[model samples]
Target: MSGLKKVIIPEMPPLEREMIALRIANMLEEGSYVNLGIGIPTLVSNWIEGRDIILQAEIGMLKSGPLAEEGQEEQDRINASCQFICAMPGSSYFDIETSFAMIRGGRMNVAVLGALQVSAKGDLAGWNNPSRGLGKVGNIGGSMDLAVGARKVIVAMEHFTPGGEPKIMSECSYPLTAKACVDVIVTNYAVIDVTPDGLVLKEAIPGVTAEDIQKMTAAPLKVAADFKEMEL
Candidate 1:
């Protein structure tokens, strides 16, 4: 935890589709080679059009651009989710073997993934929803590999479940995709860091206090000394 000065906050809206994506996109560093997982994490490319980050798709894409404009996509250009996407000027494509090699070799700088549950200790469980019934689970795909392969893993999703339950907890009740792999968590309500001390609150959405988010999580929170409301 390095020193981060405070910033002015604007009014926050409910977590619409783009808000979550914006939060994640803002965390990217210049020249980072990042892989975005399916679901909400896929929306990140839409928000980072001008950034220098390289968007890597496990199905063999490099330097991919944002989602294609409706009806303006090339059928051959798609992402890991099989969704149409735009390619950057110097974008290139390869084979699945090459894609997984880059990931498994730890060449990716970051990975943004959606999660069903994330613990204060950084354990992730996005692959399955245990209560959904036997034989009904979400796809694991390459998330397990990307979680540990990337230099940093960031979980992006709604702050709570559809039933208004906290997604961040003291311990995950579902099957974990990876243990202690998440470095940061960006939710609609706040940005939290999984530090050795505990879940540390780094920033909060506007019009909300740090205490407001603490009550929503099952885990104990550590507010930074200079915690500020998020400007975005």
Candidate 2:
């Protein structure tokens, strides 16, 4: 998909996902066991490549890595997205049972996932958008398991859809993946924390005002007392 043309979205900056990816990666503490969902969350592996953070995949790989180059792809050693990857030192493998067990057993410290719509109450709906003809037969993979199983569920996605629709809403319009599962949301414009008081704006990118974010968002946002510009 390199050099791919994006004709539908022309308003947003091109490197938005990259910046958001790094921001989410930096939030992880050392030695945190993380399950990175597909899409933007997958890029986090590139950010934490050398650190001690362990990456887990529901497709039976652990201590995973970024996508392999064209000639290096190995079918047997692919990640959940079936993309070939290089295994890091001390990486391990298991059957599907134990793979999901790690997720369902609460062994994962963090689950970084992509989202479609996330409510202020932290309700998640990453799968199945009826408007897009996506939810019918089997898209719910390990997202639900990771959502409720992880100690912290951090969603990494664009702040809004390609058509300028807010993905962060007062309530999710899509089918529920998990209720109050998202703890943090990292987007192109701001970093938000889902709290008992609702979504709090933790940080905003430089030059992007809170009013800009509020206009793009569908729900009310609580500005954090320590709100500041994002370092990245």
CA lDDT scores, all candidates in order: 0.85, 0.85
In model 1, how large is the Cα lDDT of residue 58?
A: 88
Q: TM-score each candidate.
A: 0.89, 0.91
Clashes of each: 0, 0
With a 3 Å backbone cut-off (N, CA, C), the pairs that clash in candidate 1 are: none
lDDT of 2 by residue, 1-232 (tens): 1121222333435347888899988899998999999899988887887788989989898888777888988788988877888877688989999998999899999999999899989999888777666556548888999999999999999877775577888888888889999999999888999999999998887777777677777789988989998886
Q: How close is each model in CA RMSD to the real structure?
A: 6.3, 5.2
Candidate 2: TM-score? 0.91
Q: Once model 1 is optimally superposed onto the true structure by TM-score, how far is the C-alpha of residue 90 displaced, in angstroms?
A: 1.9
Per-residue lDDT over 1-232 for candidate 1, one digit per residue giving the tens place of the 0 to 100 score: 1122223333556467578888888888999999999888988878887778998988899997777898898998898899888887899999999998999899999999999999989999999887766555677899999987889998998887876678888888888898999999998888999999889999988788887878777789999998998866
Model 1 spans with C-alpha error above 4 angstroms: 1-13, 70-72, 135-138
Query: Residue 130 deviation, candidate 2, in Å?
Result: 0.4
Q: Model 2 segments beyond 4 Å from truth?
A: 1-15, 134-136
| Superposition error at 206 for model 1 (Å) | 1.5
